[model samples]
Target: QYRLQYKMTVREELYRQIKAHLDLIGINAADELFIFDGEADAEVYNRAVKHVDLWNHNVEFLEQETPWERPAVFIEFQPIKWKAIVTGVEYRADVFANLHVVTDWNEGDGIGEFQLLEKIHEVLAGLCGSNFMEFDIDTSMTNHNHEEVVENIETYHCIGFRHLK
Candidate 1:
């Protein structure tokens, strides 16, 4: 299974910009916007490519968020998968790794880059799997409190498992 949490702040126009880009890429609003689940290795790679393509299209938005700010996105890939027991015996384990990408958009003298990076490291340490859960964190300006704002981040959690009896 793979999961992802994405956070970002953009002007209404920018939001429209992103939507337009998505449309241009043929990703319809009705499409499964979140939770990309797949069973095959090729499927997994395709899903990740889709997300990266979207991000590339909106790379300008990140740049606009902070003037003269170079925000680098880092993703930690963690793979996890489920196994089934058959004939009173357990079969081989299915493996996957979760992907966690964290960056700083604090835009102040609060925390150092390394410190922010460490926060994600701590979070990734707790996750285990070969099926990756990918998370994209955009810590930018917001009207809501820290916890509330963090919760608002869009997350795409996916699972790819098959058990046969």
Candidate 2:
């Protein structure tokens, strides 16, 4: 008999790497991070809003609901603000997460802990406008309100090689 490896395994590994990275920077991310394999939940958003500092931020490994679901995984972050967010807030699914060959992602799903640091750094720099590293994020978008902008840092999509060798 033959069997196939699940991408969730990769996603889970990736999550640990990312959580560790955040933790290295003095963040208690393990307790705040999560993974959901289906459609993004609005309840998570509600929980995030109700407990802005206590909700579980989520990550999802996509299986192609559309052409936009090409990335290895996507993350949903805590919104910047929570007031007057409207009854049904619109969640933008546009984001691009990648590293400029910072690490070898072709070996297997596991992209070692050290390499993971560089990878996560690149991703955060791209979408967060951090000058730590340079990378292109054309697919990225941001929402604003009166120039007192609070970016949506809770969500991110990590672009990675899918082949399991």
Candidate 3:
């Protein structure tokens, strides 16, 4: 007898792919963003990532009690509902998530966070992976924390699909 194996769900696969992409593009803790017309420069500048991980909803960091790195990037995934596409063989879902771009407001004249946000948005928006399609930037906003850390959350939307072979 022969059998086919399924590794992960659509949501998990989508998350993995996006995380890998962000890891590849890189997020640095640099003071100034060397914005140039060349793409290679951007890639090099992004390689200075300090912290990048999936947000665990840790309130300690938000309460200004925990001491974390200056610049960080966290990915938070929203709940997804999978719908049957071809009876039971295929599934599809509308994926949504936010990229939390965090940086210290006291660093580099207090605008590096926004610059980093722009670089992240450029690299992530419209990104197409194997299982997931292009990701679109839906909205973005800034929030100031008690620790003088500024966070720019960019919400992204994408379509995820899965198939059983």
Model 3, residue pairs in steric clash: 27-49, 28-48, 28-49
Cα lDDT tens digits for candidate 3, 1-165: 977776776556656766655554444365454334456766556553467777775423666446556467778888878889897798878888887777766755766667777766766778766567878889898876546667778899998877775
* lDDT (tens digit, per residue) of candidate 1 on 1-165: 866654231122222332232222221244222222334433433221122112331233443543222223322223443455464343333322222222334555434434433433333333323322232232422122332111112222333223332
What's the CA error at residue 157 for candidate 3, in Å? 0.4
Model 1 has an lDDT value of: 0.29
lDDT of each: 0.29, 0.29, 0.69
Worst 10 residues of 1 by lDDT: 147-156
By lDDT, who's the top model here?
3
Better of 2 and 3 by lDDT: 3
Better of 1 and 3 by lDDT: 3
Candidate 1: Cα lDDT at 19? 29
Per-residue alpha-carbon lDDT of model 2 for 32-123, expressed as tens digits? 32222233432332211111111122122113222221111233332222222234542212223332111112334333323333344543
